[model samples]
Target: MTVSHLFMQNYTGPLMIALQYNDLFDLDSISTSTDTDALPNGRAFTFIKAVQTVNERLVEQNKSDCLLFEVILISKECSEEIKMKVDESVKHYGLEIGKFFFCKKEELINTLQSNKVKLFLSTERDDVYEALHTGIPAALLYDQADDHVLNQLKVIFSGDVIGFSEDSLDGLSEFGFSETQIETIKTAKICMKEFAVLIGQMRRRFGQENSPLCTCVLTSWGSRNVCASALKTLREWGLDVDEAFCLAGAPCSPILAVVKPHILWDGGLLNMS
Candidate 1:
């Protein structure tokens, strides 16, 4: 089919996209390094192509204005390359590219809110989920065949309060919990117990044992209950950890969420969809 036809088929919402580049995946000319260490990969190229295709499709659909664009620096080097390429490409296409690099998470959120970005695009699912929970429309792109997780995310972005799957529930058992308990946690509306348990476990695993461990909980923005629950749970888990105090009502980056070296626990109840 034609480009417009393809664009029409994929997305119906305004597209707010974040660019990711792994040097291995991006073209050499388009890639630059902002840091001393830069590892290029094939994934960067894949995302670049995806972004171009998506943008082209948006233009074809006459929804180009709906496609907001930004580049998140996964690495210092990768960030610089992305900025250079985005500048060149936008001019070449006569497209108004979104801001170049977001060095801090707060800046990124500000840009999104200021621009009223609707849909987010990135190869990272973790970032997408964070954005979705925060009331932003998101389009996630990941190589892993995580359909179960993706389905949950789709529901969340569509305004669902919680998202879960049996498969995801099953995955949680690794952290310690029976099948029945896992199911219950998945359905929790307020997320009190789950937060407590997650923090508790992390304390025991990291704080008490001195293991090289850190805890990160992705909560819905403005969900005071979830944040409170997470703090309580961690304390009970015996972790002498201070809450780093992630913003409760900010958009999250799905891609960055997964890459961080921490085991994520969904200490919330699973509701029936």
Candidate 2:
């Protein structure tokens, strides 16, 4: 049997999200210091809180299952004490949605596959790229110190091709645009579809008008036809966004500033700063 076939056999059960443990918690600090009051990374804490809220909403809607959040430590340097501290911190922060696995960097991919990880998140760009290249949806988590919106889980996606398949936007970019524009739109779609499903579930469970999950789409496509085609495709796929912006060739920073999404899935195209 083919390798792809073998891989598919392990893709079972609820949507599993594999997060690099270091991305969510400060391993270096935990290992070297004995401070018991150290907190989880600010951004990581907010992300986990948002997901836990999502799970609560799912339960309210009578859903039996919740999205699984798995923490993976891809390192060989951690001591047993460090692992114990990390576990304590996870429970203390109420972020223990799933179990933790410690493995070497080389064993990361196999570990993820065996766990049926539908999405993999890491602070390392190389790791995210590797996961995407291996057909696993992945995103790079950026560290920010500013306070995020705590009441809601906000997510933003780049519309052109970030969350969409390249073939979906094929023949729509015939406009006389520069090479840069074409390249930006042709960037990887990665995990947009998976995120859409997540957002959709949140919206359904919490009611669209009162949903705690806010979603937006930001696209660089300025032409009306292109924007319309993209929106049409989203609708056909049963994906809906609360807001959308079409910035012809403008920098996405301004929109990002206002949205302040906990997660921005842009297929590694735009700067997350």
Candidate 3:
């Protein structure tokens, strides 16, 4: 099935995002520190706040029922002490309860699948890769020290294959820019489209002017024909990105520096390493 078809099939349901508990909390610090004032990870709190802001906007517009946003924190192992610390952190951060779970590392994938997670986030590259391989949209979380927090949640998507798999690009070298290749790229099934659909629904319900979310498409397809085709595909899929940059063969660091997206779904194409 094409990415568009997958998106159309699941866009109406709630967007369940599963985040690694270790990514959000400095477990080591909480466990080792003698100080009683340790705080949760700033980046994690910012992301949570951004999502909450969107949910608030949706409620204000009376569209919360149309698109539900849910977040779950998954921890590989949790002791009572750690759980108590985490609970304190959640309350300290002014977050809601009932969002944390303790599961074995071996059962993480099953947990995500059973919960029908639309996105998975982790600080470990291997964990993100594992989730991607399991056909779940996942991204590596990066720590940002900057104190400035944007009320709007910014998400970036790469136009190429949206997951870790590169098999979808196998024919590109053979066909080059031929019509067959262009059509293949246009119709290729990708994981990011599911995220696109979620963002699209948010944009539609919250209104572009007042929405708490911003989305961008950063692609290497700079040629007019390829870029047009990719964007046309997005439009047909009901995803209208707020910004798009055609980098051709240029480095993406410059653009990423400016965008500073809270989450990026590049499927390893952007060399985020």
Q: Best candidate, TM-score-wise? A: 3
Candidate 3 clashing pairs?
none
The count of residue-pair clashes in candidate 2 stands at: 0
The lowest-lDDT stretch of 10 consecutive residues in candidate 2 is: 3-12
lDDT comparing candidate 2 with the true structure: 0.61
- Tell me the tens digit of each residue's lDDT in model 1 across 25-55: 3446443544332334343343443344434
Q: 1 or 3, which is superior by TM-score?
A: 3
TM-score of 3: 0.81
Residue-wise C-alpha lDDT for candidate 2, range 95-134, written one tens digit per residue: 7456578787788888878876767767676676667667
Candidate 1 local lDDT, residue 6: 45
lDDT of each: 0.39, 0.61, 0.67
The TM-score measured for candidate 1 stands at 0.33
Q: Give each model a TM-score.
A: 0.33, 0.77, 0.81
Which candidate tops lDDT? 3
